[model samples]
Target: MPKLLASAYKELLLLTRDIGGLAVLFLMPLLLVIVITTVQDGSFKTIKQNKIDILLVDKDKGEVSQTIHDNLRTSDMFNIIEQSNENEAQKLIQNGKYQLAIILPENLSNDLNLKIAENVDGILAKFGVDESEDLPGTIQIEPKEVKLFFDPATQFSFRNAIKSGINQMVSKIETKSIYKAFQEEISEDSNEEIFDTESFIIFKEIIPNSGKEAMIPNSTQHNIPAWSLFAIFFIILPLSINMVKEKNQGTFVRLRTHPVSYATVLGGKAIVFLLVSLIQFALMLVVGIFLFPLIDLPQLNISGRLPLLFVVALFAGLAAVGLGLLLGTIAKSQEQSAPFGATFVVILAAIGGVWVPVFAMPQLMQTLSNLSPMNWGLNAFYDVFLRNVGFIEILPEIGLLTLFFIATTFIAIIYYKRKNAV
Candidate 1:
């Protein structure tokens, strides 16, 4: 036990001696947390602000078109700008300058009036206009107006607000037409059911609101958060590659000759690298707290399982270091060890939900994820943070991760002994 403790201590001191390793153990995670948090927060803030530019081109310039344009301009939803033509509007959209553009068609008023006239109480209404300007008795015309185009950039909040405003303006015109038809039918002594039958067309069944509207789609949020945490955890690979660097520098031989067993030296190195992983985890957690509203850290009700969660996180860090150690110890040189460590970490991280969430993946991929410590570690974090689970909820994950640490550490020990035996 004393020998083991001494080995662990020596490994820890050796890791601490490397300035680059110390920086990685402490600073790299902090940097990643800062970056991800900034991006996530900025994106959500842009969505909430609901600021989108729209270009309007009115071809008709008629009263109805003007009214439609005015309606859009008056609303707080859009930053409406008048453009000379559709070409400029499209150019702006292509350049990502505007979210969407509205184009008013020529004769917009006439088209609306044509629809209005169809429901008019008239007998001698002609469908086509005469080519010759012949003398006519007189005719009253009503116009139907429409928005020729809508902006695709306008999302639900902005679109809904615009839709509501337009509906209000059009409802008055529609109501007058309805009243006129009702009076005509009443005068003709038609049965009430005839009018009632038409009323059904206007009324629709109400759709009940579903529970807990997600801020973003569940799949997007779930996968992003899960993978973000996975990256932070997978950083252990680069950190552990330093062991191979030490071996190449002759430090490994010198340390072994200084009355230290192979286990003590390697064990200490693993602990130091493991410490680095933990620091990164903490930095990510801090960034999540300060930077992204998507992650409600303080609200995470994992008090009952905090201790267990910490233990799991710590063990996961150790497991990552152990994997790195096994690879580094087996490789011929630091150059070889570095790439192998990086590739291995990346593969494990990918499978573990660093790049995607297991739940959102296919069944085959989900099964594959079970082989990665990252998958288990991230799933446990999600359980504590999102699902409000207790220690019992994550026991299996913790146990799996603990076993991974033991297995990897054993492999690393055996490999180191074989490679460095004097």
Candidate 2:
């Protein structure tokens, strides 16, 4: 038993000596908080910094066509790049120099003219849609019409601007086309009556339900869970490296010869690593709750959700330790383990939406994220942090994670036993 305490003390000292371990335990988590907060600064600041670079290719020189180009360029949200050709514009967009490319067809004027004629003919031929002939002369052309091309990943404000711009252009085009037909009619002296008309275009609207007042979960709330899961999961690498260092330094073998049962040895080491992981978890939770407040964190209320939230954080840490132990046991040296451990952590974090919000991810990638612990952990976090849920809200997540921890620990033990036998 004396040897066990000495070995545990030795393990703690070895961990202290590791500069990287010290950074992970004490510094990196704080840095992550600072980075996440200061990176965007604030919403208004972000919007002010946000401007979409659009590549403009004006293949058509017609007044109407140029009007479309002019309108888009005059926008504060869009910064126009006058590229030589569509090919160059597309190259710039692909190279990430431009967020979107606007391609104006050489025959856009002709197309507009042709469409207007068709529309006028359709209206005149209608049975009861129009009955009067008070149609006005030539369509009015605004000098500020413009077309826009947007990068799919452009900021939300810019995207909305683009949508508005599109509607504005279409409405202007439709109005001008109708007026041109009326002008032709006035010049030729129409015999029958034609009705004056104005109609609104049926443009579609997209509204994201923020539910800020109602406290319902929204798309952005998922980021809190995803980021927390990945951040906690990443602590596994430091934990594993510490374990592997102990084994390589002959500390593990010396502890193995102790009079205490093997179970006790394993239990003590697991407890230490679990404590280390929990420390990291605490840092993340503190940063998440107090420092970089997410958009819609639920108020700490009468809901018994704090316990569930803590459990979620705790279970996530435990699962990470189980993974780290498995990884550490499989590698004979820290050098051998570091690469695989780091790579696996990165891949999982990326898949779990730590690198980018899941809402921004492609559908296929979003579906695939479910295979990682990041998904379940994030779901549990979101349930508490955003939904203001009770313990029941996270029970399924807790149950699943408990099963995962047990399975991973079982595998780690099996592999370690096999390694010992060898």
Candidate 3:
């Protein structure tokens, strides 16, 4: 116990003496959390407003085109500016004023009505009515298209949503047109029982999206966990370099004379770096939860999973320390450890989704991200911070990180024994 305490004291002395590295250990992540969250919070404000920039140009001088146009004018979701000229609408879209433009082609109503007349005539023939006498005659439709002009640069939240809305509007107009023809047929024949077009489609209220909306885009929810894991893993560079430097300088040689096993020495140093990692985690969380709200930024709502966060942080620290030990024991000197350790940490961070969320990555990248311990730690943190999940929900992540720590610990210890035996 005395030897272990001495080892820990020695470790802290080494770290405390390097004042600048110590500052980076604590302050850099705070700065990143604040900066990242600020940028993302601004975007969230726009999304919460739920407004769309739309330009509508209707060339068809008919009831169906006019009806759809009138609906757009009153819609709260669309901030539409109707233009009589399609060229003028195109100019506005190019100037970045609008994301989407709906161009209703000329003769749109005539083409749709022709299809409706053909359907009605078919129905009349089935019911033993003369198609020529009882039904409105069908005309040949000169096919024309409804053009959708959009600015590709505009940050349209849902591409499918805009398309779906336009489709629904067109369908409704076609339905009403067919129903008008059906009413004419009902007047001539006594079959109101089989065809009640007025009450065919029912409209239901769409409840607002639940707060569990995927990918809320809040920086506070993302930056804290992401940057915290990044900062923790960054400790590897210094930790591994210090180990190799001390070994090269004969510091380990002298320490071995003490009345303690080498494992005790290893355990003590791990404790120190692990504590540093935990401190980084706590400070980042504090800034996200308290300091951010004061600046009108998002609150770091942990969603009542503090214990799960602690468990994740604990395993994450162990994984980082184990990785550091492996690199330090394998490297021959600071020259070998410094660049290699930093590069290793950086590559792991990149793959682990410290800069981007794994859920948002390409399918192949998401699969690759699973190989990184940083990803496991980050996923666990996201579960606590974003998903409002309990400890049970994060058990798999915690277990994976724990196994990673155990595996690296064994590898590092085996290498250390081999080096010492030589």
Candidate 4:
């Protein structure tokens, strides 16, 4: 017990003396979280609070074209800039002056109405309602295309959304035209309305709640947990470097003369670094809770989940420390350990949904992400912060992290003993 405490004290002293390492561990992550959160918050607000600029070229100058223009103008999503020349609109889109443009074909309204009227007449004659010999046996109407011009830089998802919206609007207009044609044929003498144009089915979004209030996750909620986990795992870089330094300096040789096991030495390093990880997490929470709102970002709400958040952080720290121990044991020098540790952490973060979300990734990458310890930690953090889950709900992720720590630490111990054996 005395040896373990003394070893922990020595590790603490070494960490405190390295000012640059301490700065890297603490300051860089704080800045990263703040900047990333701010940028993402702006993106989140783009569709809801800001309008996209779109050019409308109505070549038809008919009821259909006018209706399309009116719909675009009325929609909160688009800021319509009417352009008379289709060629000019296309130029503007290609030059990136505008993100999108919609072109309605000439005589769209007339042709659409004629097609509907002819179809209705044919249907009425089939039902024996129209007995007139003047009814044509065949009907033909040329198809009209609505052209969409998009900026080259426009995202595929945004383009798809715009295309879908325009298609839906045109379909509604076509349906209304059909209804009017039928009404005119069925009841030419009546003055009352026949068809209801208003939508019957509407979509409603349901958010999961904890019997109190719904915990809607914003950028702050997402960035804080994600980047904090990143910062925690990044401890491996310095931790591994420190281990390599001690070996290079003959500190390990001096410690061998004492009555100590390698596990005790590992335990000492784990205790100090675990405390550092917890402190790093706490500082991140402080910044999210306090600094974000001042910068016009949403405040992070930990509320009753603080304890569970810490529990996940603790286990995540253990996993990080275990990885550091293994890397340090295997690596022969500081140059080897430092680069590998940093690069490996980045790879883990990339695959673990730290940069891009798991759901957004391809099927193969999503499958591979399960192998990362950072993914486990990130999931556990999200379960507490966003999902508002309890300890029991987060047990699976916590269990995985615990097993990772045990396995890595065990391998590191075995490797160290084998290498130094008489």
When summed lDDT is taken over every stretch of 10 residues in candidate 2, the lowest stretch is 295-304
For candidate 3, the 10 contiguous residues with the lowest summed lDDT are 206-215
TM-score-best of 1 and 3: 3
**Sort by TM-score, best first: what order?**
4, 3, 2, 1
The parts of candidate 4 lying over 4 Å away from their true place are 137-139, 210-212
Candidate 4, backbone clash total = 0
Candidate 4 residue lDDT tens string, 1-422: 88889989999999999999999999999999999999999998997789998888887999998888899888888898889999999999999999998888888999999898888898998898888968775657789999999999988988898899989999999998888888887886656679887888889998766675657888998999999999999999888988999999999999999999999999999999999999999999999999998999999898898999999999999999999999998999988998999899999999999999999999999999999999999999888887777899999999999999999999999999999999
Candidate 1: tens digits of C-alpha lDDT, residues 255-365: 776777766766666665666666666555555445445553221233354565566678677667666666767777767876766677678777887765567789998
The digit string of per-residue lDDT tens for model 2 on 1-422 reads 67566555655676778887678666666576455545534543435556556677777677666777777777666677777677777666767767778777666676677667756755774644446656555555433334455555667867686677677776776676677676675455554335444555566754333543224443224444455566677766776777787788886787667665444554555666666766665665565556554543322231455567678878887777678767777777878788888788888878776777677889999998877776677777766766666687688877777777788878877776676774
Off by over 4 Å in 3: 70-76, 95-97, 129-138, 155-158, 187-219, 333-336, 355-363, 386-389
> For residues 246-353, could you state the per-residue lDDT of candidate 3 as single tens digits?
888899898777677777777878899999999999998899888999999978776456677878898899889988888887889888888988788888888899
Pairs with steric clashes in candidate 4: none
Whose lDDT is greatest here? Answer: 4
Candidate 4 local Cα displacement, residue 108, angstroms: 1.1
Instruction: Quote model 2's TM-score.
Output: 0.65
Q: Please list the C-alpha lDDT of all candidates, in the order they appear.
A: 0.62, 0.66, 0.81, 0.92
